[model samples]
Target: MLRTTEQKRKYIQATRSQNYQASLKLEGITTTAQTTQQSKAEILQKYKKYSQPES
Candidate 1:
């Protein structure tokens, strides 16, 4: 049986998350559910600022 496109995408996302968590664990950093709407917005804003070029 073959997986659908959405299923493949989900599998890849899960794999990436697992890999990231494992790397953090190896570094003695535990994962936490500390992300809130404000934090997400702040992160996005920081990225937006970082992605802009000098004018």
Candidate 2:
């Protein structure tokens, strides 16, 4: 019973470390991805001088 408990603890720690590493890598990727995706309000502001006709 003690051995199993220890194994479970190690397994959890290993998985948590792996997840943390993956998240660290993804943080960089997400930051760049987010910058590339422009919001509608920002797009409008960029061309604010030219107004779009009503639909």
Candidate 3:
């Protein structure tokens, strides 16, 4: 069975949000351990870039 366009959009949105949230949580833990702003920014930036939809 094939999914509709709206279904695909919803799926992508849900996945992106989940990935973003998970990454944020990971960043929090890592920051607590190391206390480095640069590293945290790098990690979160990488995650967001990787999770972004390909054009």
Candidate 4:
């Protein structure tokens, strides 16, 4: 089944949050500010790549 745009966005957000949380947990860091910031940047880059309009 195909996912709607909202579903896709939610999925991405959830996955990114999960990954950041896991990273922080594995590193035994209580604060994930830096990691979360970096993850957001990476996620934006990926979205930009895939969301670019076709020529």
> What are the models' TM-scores?
0.55, 0.45, 0.48, 0.49
For 1-55, candidate 1 gives per-residue lDDT tens digits of 4379988888888789788888998999987845234777788998999999999
**Candidate closer to the true structure by TM-score (higher is better), 2 or 3:** 3
Model 2 agreement with the true structure over 1-55: per-residue lDDT tens digits: 4369889899888789677767978786332323255899988887884785667
Query: Which model, 3 or 4, shows the larger lDDT?
Result: 4
Q: Tell how far residue 43 is off in model 4, in angstroms.
A: 22
The segments of candidate 1 whose C-alpha lies over 4 angstroms from its true place after superposition are 33-42, 45-55
Best candidate, TM-score-wise?
1
For model 1 the TM-score comes to: 0.55
RMSD of 3: 13.7
RMSD of 1: 6.0
lDDT for residue 25 in candidate 3, whole number 0-100: 88
Clashing pairs in 1: none
lDDT of 2: 0.70
- Per-residue lDDT for 1-55 in model 4, tens only? 5379998888889899888888988988786355434577888898899999999
- Report residue 48 deviation for candidate 2 (angstroms): 52
Question: Would you give me the overall lDDT of model 4?
Answer: 0.80
Please report the candidate that would top lDDT against the real structure.
1
Candidate 3 lDDT over 1-55, as tens digits, reads 4289988888888789677767978787332323344777789998999899998
